[model samples]
Target chain A: MRCEKSGRIEVSNLCKRFHKAGKDPLQVLQNCTLTIEPGKLNVLIGPSGCGKSTLANILAGYDSPDSGEITIDGSPLKGPGTDRLMVFQETALWPWMTVMENVIFGPTVRGEMSKKEAREEATRILELVGLQDFKDKYPAQLSGGMQRRAELARALINRPKVMIMDEPFRGLDDLTRELMQEYYLKIFEKTNCTTLFITTELEEAIFLADRILIMTFLPGRIKTIIDVDLPRPRNYHVLTSKKYLQIKAEALEYLIEEGRKCFGEDCNIANTMVDEFRRQADNRH
Target chain B: MNIYFVLPLFVILSFIFFIFYRQQKRLAHYSGISTLSQIKKTLTSQRFWLVILGFVLTIGFWYAAVYWLPFDAFHRLPGPDEVVIEWLSRDPYYGISIYTKEYYVHILYSTYRATVSFLLATILGVPFGLLMGWSRRFYEYSFPLVEMIRPIPPLAWVPLSILMLPGVEPAVIFVTFLVAFFVTTLNTLLGVQSIDQAYFRAALCLGASSKEILYDVVIPGSLPYIFTGLQISMGAAWFSLVAGEMIAAQYGLGYLIWQGYSLVKYPTIIIGMVTLGFIGYGSSAVIRYVGKRLMAWREQELGGLGVTYEE
Candidate 1:
């Protein structure tokens, strides 16, 4: 999908290695290259244990790739900066700091402005997040959904060029998750931020992303990129539509195939041979 | 157990009654006139007299312990009267001046020395903790040395303190400082380390300098831990002060208690012990009170509990 190139985030030839048992090296992401369009919600989805989270971490500067280049608006990403703010799945709002203080924390610490000025800026963001009343309340005082909102407010308060998220709503109950999805969509509509979100939830990825980058299993690489040409501010009703079901089925098929591959199971099978194969395998065992 | 035991038992029972009475009184005010009548009925019961009886019983036990105990190995020690008489009628060679009642003087001396040393330790310990807590290089290099030295008791340093310092004041101060210094430093370090990593990330992303992180994030984040260290260090100061005085001093409470031991004056020794106990308890309460007030923000996060450390 063609979108405004106001902020382009690109990762080229990304490579990362982690130490495994027996001092054996496990390559996490090998020569993975991708370009995320500016002001578009790009979702990364894959089967469990895939390297989507790792890639997101690399982009967020939480982890460094052994060799790669990640550039935002043509500037290379070296370490964590206000240029990119990350929202984690489990809300990482500071329990000690109040909602207002947590939101302003980044700006106040980084900005040359006075405390009063920083607070005013924070107040504006708090209102935007529908948490104006929770300014004085600690994270514990907030509901789980509210905490996530506060976390989003904290990240967005800085007006970062790219918003990177890792399973941002994985743990919430169904109702809360749906509510958060709606809330998140509304916020995205307002800001139009270039977002790179990682999730294992196929439906969530399809619903939120302009382009969903499906990944293969371990030592992950992009399996395919499915562009969701859905209209802006897509709602829950759109989930049951023909196009939505078509996309969901395709994503599910890809994931199930990947799962079979990981488990050493053949993806294709015949009904007659299934029983015979099981009997043969059982006899051999 | 008899009536002697009855007094303590009664005191405990009466304490329970007082708590219930207070609860009823609070409920009465909250629940309007109906509950007021109920509260009054509860209050009018003979439970109040039971409290009075309990107090009388305690006095009776005291008099019995004082007047009737035979001067034997385990007899209830001297009653208040005998102890009072002994206190009043004693001929004072030096008298009860600011310097004489070694109980009072020793308390003063011990308190002064411990306070001065603890303050000095705080001045050094807080900064050191902040440095070690905030700086990777400092934490990596200094933490190992601190860990090795921290477990070594302050009493172990008394000999070194005496040899190193030119005077007795220096020695006592050094020993007390050592006792409190580690607690303050380690507590501050933990406090700094325990601060949410997000706070640092938030600040760092904001373009905060390392110096700003120390002053703005690490110090404030670790204040609770620093206060905790100070409180613990106060206790350590008292402990080390006594040990220091016992080994190489002539004036503090420990020295007086030691002198009383040499002379076989058990009461004097007990008085000195009580004095030390009272000072230690009093200082702790003060530290806790101040810590709570200063760390009001912590209470919001941790309920009424002062500071709850997270693993």
Candidate 2:
């Protein structure tokens, strides 16, 4: 897309395990490997609880992989830095701070930029996120979608090379979710920063990504990677287009296969998913 | 000595009231209302009279129980009128009343000891709590001591405090301090623990330093619980203060009550109890007032109910 993002992230053979005190060690991410090209949007799609979030956390340097090497632009990616920022699913905008304060929290704490300069930068970024009107309101006072926008504003102000978002709009209502997806796509095209978005929503994955990585069930491994070759400035109308339906069907098949493997006596989750995908496939915008 | 303590208290109180009055006036003007009329209306309201009536009936029951009870079970109890009569008269009796310098001296001494002890507890305990909450090593080092010491009543420390400190006054203050200190430390620790993990992760991703985390995350995050702890600590401070006063002090409401008990001048005991009740209530009110001021964020977040614990 010819963007200005400066870092290339290479996560090779990443393996992570969580140990419980009185039980067997549980493996989460297994031999996960991927390279996120700079200035591109890459979405990781998988079933719920499939370690996509754990992978995102590792990539963002919030947690270390038990066995792996992560490199950013050929240099070893260190623990959390200004180079990588995360927007949490729950929108972790500091409740104690106004939107403006949350946006400037990074630079203010680091003192890398002067207070006035940070304030100016924060204001600019908040305006871009369409949160200029809510600059004085605390996160508690904002709606769920507004809170997500505020979080996006906070992350953007840091000017990170890679922004990792874990199900950033998962909790919004259906209407808000659709609007947020459109809004997010617009923001991503402008910033053109490398973004790795983790979500189970297949439609969201297709809409946001230049590349999509599908993962298997628990002990999650990268099943396959598909490139979304849709033209730029793709809107909601593209959902009805033939090429998008073909891609959506392909993604759905991969997900149904994975979902079936996790089925139990009580949970017909896979069958339900298949039916839902079919209904969505039939109902064109 | 009475004048020295009483003078600053008057000055400080007047200054506070002056600020409060100005704020009230400014707010009233902004709202297009008069403060005096509003206050007068509030004073004359049904709710106000109901509260007054409730108080009189409750006290009337106490007086009736003392005067008209059939047995000697309530013999030591004095009617409210008896306490009032003693208050208005001179006390070779060593009671709380406007008539005596001795009463003021006792009140001032108790206030001083309580103030010094409570301040020390907060200063020492809060940081200790933060350390324990923030670092695993600190929790390991101190948690066991806290777990052991916290459950034991502050009164239990009275004998040990008497042995440890050189003077009676210091011992008494030490006991009171222990009660408040433990409350602040434990509550501050819980506040830190209760903070969402997402905030810490978000701050780390933003490249915040450990020091920044302490101030921005730990302090603000734990503040709600810290305030809850302050209320508990203040109550404990009063409890320990009265216990120490009764046991070791030459003057105080507690000492007066004890003296009245020993002499069987029962109305002085009622005066001491009533005075302690007022002071305890006052101290707790002050803590809550400070809490409300510092936690204005929570007040707005919860829409002013001050009781919601849900995230």
User: Worst 10-residue stretch by lDDT in candidate 2 chain A?
Assistant: A261-270
Relative to the unseen true structure, what is the C-alpha lDDT of residue A91 in candidate 1, on a scale of 0 to 100? 71
RMSD of each: 7.9, 5.3
Candidate 2's C-alpha runs over 4 A off are A1-3, A18-27, A66-68, A264-285, B1-53, B89-96, B305-311
Cα lDDT of model 2 by residue, B12-74, tens digit: 579867865776676566556798765565567898699879999999888778888675777
Off by over 4 Å in 1: A1-5, A21-23, A266-285, B1-103, B196-198, B305-311
- Model 1, span A1-285: residue lDDT tens: 112345688889888889978987888788888888888999988887878878987887778999989888888878877777778777767665678887877777775456798788778877877888888887766677888888988888777888888888888888888888888988888788888888888889888889998888877878888999888788988786767766666666677666666667654653234445445444544
Q: Score each candidate by Cα lDDT.
A: 0.77, 0.83
Q: Give candidate 1's chain B TM-score.
A: 0.71
Q: What is the per-residue lDDT of model 2 for residues A1-285, given as tens digits with 9 covering 90 to 100? A: 223567789988999999999999889898888888888899999989889889988877778999988999999987788788888878787788788889999988888788899999888888777888778876777777888988998888878888888899997989999999999898888889888888889989998899999999878898999999988888998887877887887788788788766675454766687677667767754
Q: CA lDDT of B252 in candidate 1? A: 88
Interface RMSD per candidate = 6.8, 5.6
